[model samples]
Target chain A: MYPKSIKDLIEDFSKLPGVGEKTAERFVLFLATQKEKDGILSFSSHLKEMTDKIVKCERCHMLTEDTICDICKSKERDTETLMVVSDSKDVFVFEKMKTYHGQYHVLDGVIDFSKGISPEDLNIDSLLKKVASYKEVIIATNGTVEGELTAKYLKALLSDFNLSITRLAYGLPVGSDLKYADELTLNKAVENRQKY
Target chain B: MYPKSIKDLIEDFSKLPGVGEKTAERFVLFLATQKEKDGILSFSSHLKEMTDKIVKCERCHMLTEDTICDICKSKERDTETLMVVSDSKDVFVFEKMKTYHGQYHVLDGVIDFSKGISPEDLNIDSLLKKVASYKEVIIATNGTVEGELTAKYLKALLSDFNLSITRLAYGLPVGSDLKYADELTLNKAVENRQKY
Candidate 1:
């Protein structure tokens, strides 16, 4: 058995989302080890800094240190187009491609009834208020049932705002086998085929 | 892009084993979220405590706050029987069974040539000094090639001393299928068959 402080550290680490007890122990051991002194110091300092400084963007609900996130404040991005997603991470995923020049709105929660994530818990109000500035609102939520439900709800909510509501088309992935495609996705792909 | 402090936190989280960039982002975001305030405080405090307080046991090289570990100082354990291991985690794995009342010696590392962990880097001198007091030494290092090399080297190191050196038997795990057993393990199991 370890000392009280180490035991508490391991317990706290295990409480993190993905780390289990064994992994938590390993992390603690690494922290206490002689080689990891510098790493531990830097990590702790960064964690403190992040918790103290990071705040949510007022318009899009994305995590940021400033009142508004970079994308929302940037003049380079297309303010007339907006992409709505479930989590802040999705904003990063879309940004990684360097293709989507539009702004983003992080819903932060989806309509997962089982998990108690209702439409009311999300930042949908800010989205509705912000949607008026954009000509097009793209529902780039996950391809799950909750995402579909959230998109439908958003579409209905923003219907009277005179903005074009578009959902990402369901199709086989870029390099997938047609034989392995799910029936629903295959059907949707066929239904939404273009002239080309 | 995220703010400076949050970005630094994500980088630190990503440095942890089994945690990727996306998972690190999720962890940092979770930390910044309103719901995780209490956990963040406790986690930081515990981390600080662990880094500041925890020290290695002088006798067996196990991590602890005291000069000697609880197991080493305990009068109830069999001081004559020493269990030698490559890491302190192995001590815990054996302890979890509630058996093995013998004393332990943590080598802390093995002959990891790839990582440049040689015998000199280990606590071998302390083990030799302490092993003389014990009649039997059980090498309970990991079942890896490095562990075997360490065991062989230890045997040679301790051959001049009057003690019975033994290695843990290689066999199918207690609840494992014989059909799924690997070739080396099966061979060892067959070679070291025990009488009922």
Candidate 2:
């Protein structure tokens, strides 16, 4: 029982992953209240500016204003090592870790058999062409079944290529002691143990 | 450790209520991903437009584009009864209920002794002037101590006026059974029981 416009906004916001009715209501109310705190005109203008100006990088598919991504265009990055992820959000996470100076390729989604997604649905062809120039391709997809299947599919597709393909080494988590590692993690850790 | 611009945007989004670091990150990423979604730019632009264009109703302090609130400017509303609320949010709630037919007066805040807010700090002077025109005043503040105190202050300030003053009667909620009501509510229910 809110105004039609308010209700519509709430419904649209509620479609987000975690927002519920209460949160949706709070968000719309918050937006409505901002009209009083800051001039509503500026807020609306900002939204339009962001939507109109923000564009995706043509090369890496990450959000950027340039024709190519900063990572892909940067001479400082190791272009020979391409880190592939299912979504751009994963790129943000790794960027937060301040690790890896290699360029990135976002698939935008995993290859899902159940959903009828195939290799043709992914940006894998571009990746294959790029692999000719790169020495290594690192698959950083999630450890879920679909992610694993996608990784396997990519491996099979790139089998004829000369570049070295690698998956992130499975092991005990950084903070977790070896003794506290779960059975599955322990088994994977043992199987993938390094010489160091 | 994302890019400086990304970090700044995330920080700004995080200032909103109920949005944490992960959520802020997700929101930014979602905005970034909108490049792939159709009409997302238009939606964002619409939000910005609303924010930029909306203005406060000078009379009732509700968010609107007009000089006075639609309710206040309406001829059908009863000018003899005024409902006072602490904020415009509460005004929205009352409007949603569609139960009250009177105009509203926003205090913006309560008379908090600790906060050094007295009756003079609020729109009480204007409210007193409104009292002359109205036959009854209803204080529809929250069920908190500050709300009670504000209501009491209004009541005392208008004690000399010939008009009737009342607070909204709240007891057990509409859906709540008497058996499920708390002891405090049950006590209040018994104490304030009415003869039919």
Candidate 3:
């Protein structure tokens, strides 16, 4: 058997999805080899800070350090449009790109028929309440079946609203080779082409 | 950009060798969803504890919580023979299977020409010192060119001493289907067959 601390930490890390026992061992051993232990010790405090400080924003259901997320509180962002996403990771991805200038509404997860999930089970109520303030709601959920199903359901739910509703563009990615593009993506690229 | 704490923690976790940015995001999100946040928070402290607690055994060069590892300190294990391993991971593997009963000398790594590693870079000096007290030395390094080179070098180093030296058996692994076994392994299996 390994040292108690090594075994315990390996179990904790291995429980994370996608991390195997071998990877867990490597991580533990790596931490042990780090000469300046403070770097690793600080990681613990950060987890605690995230646990205690991060909260669900009441306005948009995004994780934040305050009652309302920074995006919802920002004046420079386009309050005229909102992006509807499935999780905070999606929000993080968009923020990393710094391309989108709109706020987001996290649905948490898409509806799953097998799992018996419905629109009411998600953050749909808050999204419905927040969509009233935006001129447009861009459905930015991923292109999976559940994501498509959730987008359709949201469209039906918000049909009577005065604002426009749009789904994310489906076509060839920005830098992908056209020859290697899948049939569905290639077809969508042709269908959605604009005037040159 | 995300919150400072979120971004910092993601960077730390992603810096681990095998963890990608996507996997790091999933790990962080999974920790955030834990019903009891202590599970993840404790992991950080455990890492610090490992850094402060674990040390190399002075006698055998194995990782231990004390100056002498349990194996080296044990009286029941064969004192006349010792197993030479590349790393603590190999020790853990033998322990997990309850197969090996001899003490271990951790070489840490082997000579690699491409990596510019030499015998001096490993724990060879300590191994040479320890091998003098044993009657036999078993080279248990992996079946790589570097491993064989190290074993040969160790054998030459211990030839002047009274101790006999041996290498681990190389043949087809037990329970492997002969049809799927590689040509080299099949050849070794036939070359090293024992009386049935």
Candidate 4:
């Protein structure tokens, strides 16, 4: 009703992120040029299906179908040294590093007081309860201002406990020689250095 | 295992008509950034559904579920005149005009001898048969060499029949005055003018 099929399809494609009107028109033209067997309309249905299905992991707040994520279910992971992150993608980043052996806790979002997001808005309370049983908890939040505030809030919440709580150090990366490190990074590395 | 998710997704997106590696990368990244509740992995499944579903109109060769298209099934329209077009979208153009009281015949494609497409390849026999039952048949193909050639071929094919066959008169569009018309369009309009 909005338009005949072709125009309607173009309008729909244009609504997607990064697809402009011109690009939407072009995509529709390209789609129409395809042979009947290509099933362009069915593709729209499929898009709706993907958007409708799929579940997020309950334990870590990452995307997963099971009640617990693969990392949470695994016995080989270091459950006592949990890594806290803001998003699920960060978990993947840590996994790809092959260095972190600990399980993960995803906040799903960073705490932003300006946007009205407080500690309660994040999964910090559950993380604190989880940390009560562990010997150590590592805050692997990003080095941004929001991340720093979230980590500091978390540190205060756990200050009464005797467990070791560490924030992922921000310094020059490995193999990035001291000479090539940016001034701020070199300065941080110098300031945060532990006794040899 | 070879970044199974990202690698497979990149490969699949890259296989689309005009998507290159960088665009494919961007597409995968966009999908990856989406919430897992959105079923990003099921994008592949959706692609399969599109290719497997959707039907074409048997009568007009347009994308439709029924044998006869909505235009052909409408009883209020005059069935005497048939506007012959190359694809389904052309029906939209004519529908926008709302001046003609005629049904449509979608040819699907024009006769392109250079590409080995002959009169038989474009459902010309069906068009000729339909023209026999019509008072007039209008050829509304694009203003290209191939379109013209196809129109000429249709005229020759329907020469022995007792029906009037006409092509859309080439000219400047209705909104444009003769002063603004391109030289080719103005010349064509003048050449094809009828007595008022």
Candidate 5:
């Protein structure tokens, strides 16, 4: 068994998205044993600093230090094109590509009835208010069932507006062998094959 | 790109063992966005608490809240038998089995030449001082190359003392099928087979 404070820290770490009790224990012990005397102290200070400074961007619902995110504030991005994503990390993924010049709107989470998340729980009111200004709305949620459902729901909501709503195309991932491709992915790839 | 404090936190998380930059980013984002407003603040406080409290046991070199660990302080333990381990975690593992009622001596680390970790860097000085009181010294380090090397080194050093030095038996792990066992494990199991 761990010391009281160590056990408490492990419990806190276990609350993170993917970390389990064993992983949390490993993390805590590594910090306690492996790091320098001031390592954990500095790490704790950094956590405090992040908690004090980071806030959700008012316009896009993305994590930012200021009221408006850098992406939302930038004038160079194509304001007419908006990419809707489930979480803020997706924004970074798109930005890393260096090709998407459009703005982003983080929904915070997708609609999952099983988890009791509904359309009203998402950051959609402001999205609906600003929908008329965008020429195209790209639903760029993940390829999961919840992502598909959210994309479909967003499409229906934005159908009344004079904007083209589109979902990301489904296909086999790049560099993946066809032999290992699943039936659903193969079906979609065949259905949406390019002329090339 | 992440904001200043968030980026700093991510870097700190990345320093943790087995955590990469992407996983660190996910951890920071999850802490910042998914958790309640005070979650990160509380987590930081807990880290500070752990740093302020936990200390290494004077005798065994295991992490504990007091000057001596519970195991070292306990009169119920078999002080004549000592278990020499590579890390403090190994002590906990042996304790959980409830079969080993011996005292423990944490070496803190194994003799890793690649990492420039020599026996001098470990807590072997105290071990050498106290090993004479024990009737048996069990070298319970891991099965890795470094662990075996450390065990051999300890055996040579402790050979001067009156105590009997022993190594843990190597064989297939419990609940593992023979077909699934690796060649090295199979070889070790065959070489060290027990009598029915």
Candidate 6:
């Protein structure tokens, strides 16, 4: 129904995480009909640049152009505290907050039995080597089942490390209405009620 | 928040319709972290190929690799009936139905007054020349304000030509429930009700 190049582009676009065929078609059409004659060419060059330049940080497995990411190389960060997250994107989210001064260790993925992902598949070995020096290890993975499973596994593994291990607190989010909160969230909120 | 090349790629992705900063971030991350290392590079090369290959049909303004589109060059198509559409994507949609055998004239855009897009910005002059020989001209624009405006303006411009001009029927879509139909759609359905 579309030209060969357009169809091929749509196929490639569909390989992205959340893009479907319809959205891919729209994206390809936008590139094809864009008023800027050099837009698609520039976009192609940018993709090539990303492919040539981007690399993973050697120590933490986070995305960076250098061998070590800026967060890992920074001297201002709190070296005693380390946050363990499932993906590099989570590190970016935490960096946006600008509150946490701790270092990050990207696991690349979590323990998901359903998907056959396990501790060995993650960066747990490197984390074990690094954990002995940190005073605190915060498990900052998502609130999903895989995240909790990974945290539990890590806690048991790091029991002998003599460092305080903590997971992010569960409660109703700020600016959220109690009525709309799910039962589990409401329960967590009640259980973790603050001194205030 | 992201590396320079990643940020540049994200900015380019954000230019597409319906893509936002967050979605663009995800797309770049997907390309960066995909298991197939050559994925992003292949995608870049494909984009270059599209830039070099895709061209518009000389007669109808539809996208094609050659000087004339397949539909415009086909001898089996009904030359007597011409469908005027707002974009090439619309022509693809009609072709997918496998029912419409008429030739198409892509306006490339509609008469969007708010956006200052007039008939001159469209392929109206060529349409005026082609409508004379055709027995029927179907205004197959969208149901939006711009689409209707373009259809109305074309109707007046081609009124001098000796041909039957028709717009798509306004009614409840097939398989849609009357209870969920909006007031305007219900009104149009009632006014255009057929003899059952």
Pairwise TM-score winner, candidates 4 and 5: 5
Q: Write the per-residue lDDT of candidate 5 for residues B1-196, one digit (tens) a residue.
A: 7889988999999998899999998998888885576777889999998888889999999989999999899999989999999898888678778899989999999999999999999999999998889999999999999999999999999999998899999999899899999999999999998889
**Most TM-score-accurate candidate:** 6
Chain A vs. true chain A, TM-score per model, equals 0.93, 0.89, 0.95, 0.76, 0.92, 0.96
lDDT, candidate 6, at A105: 97
DockQ of each candidate's interface versus the true one? 0.63, 0.32, 0.56, 0.10, 0.72, 0.79
Note the Cα lDDT for every prediction shown.
Answer: 0.84, 0.76, 0.84, 0.70, 0.91, 0.91
After superposition of all CA atoms, the RMSD between model 6 and the true structure is 1.9
Query: Residue A50 error for model 6, in Å?
Result: 1.8
Ranking 2 against 5 by lDDT, winner: 5
Q: Residue A141 in candidate 1 has what lDDT?
A: 86
Distance from true location, Cα of B39 in model 4, Å: 11
By TM-score: ranked, best first = 6, 1, 5, 3, 2, 4
Question: lDDT tens digits, residues B41-104, model 6?
Answer: 8899889988888888988999999999999999999999999999998998899899999999
lDDT of 4: 0.70
Clashing pairs in 2: A40-B51, A40-B52, A41-B51, A41-B52, A41-B53, A42-B52, A44-B48, A44-B49, A44-B52, A96-B1
How much is A166 displaced in model 6, in angstroms?
Answer: 1.9
* lDDT tens digits by residue: candidate 1, B1-196: 6678878888887877778988888877777775666667777777777777777789988877789889989999988999999887777778888789998899989988999999999999999887888899998888888999999999999888999999998987899999999999999989988997
lDDT of 3: 0.84
lDDT of 3 by residue, B1-196 (tens): 6677676778789978878887787788766656687776787677667777888899887888989999999998988889999988788888888867888999888889899999999998887766778998999988899998988988888898998788899888888888998998889889999998
Candidate 4 CAPRI grade: incorrect
Task: Compute the lDDT of residue B101 as modeled in candidate 5.
Answer: 92
Model 2 DockQ vs. reference: 0.32
The 10-residue segment with the lowest total lDDT in model 2 chain A: A35-44
State the number of backbone clashes in model 1. 0
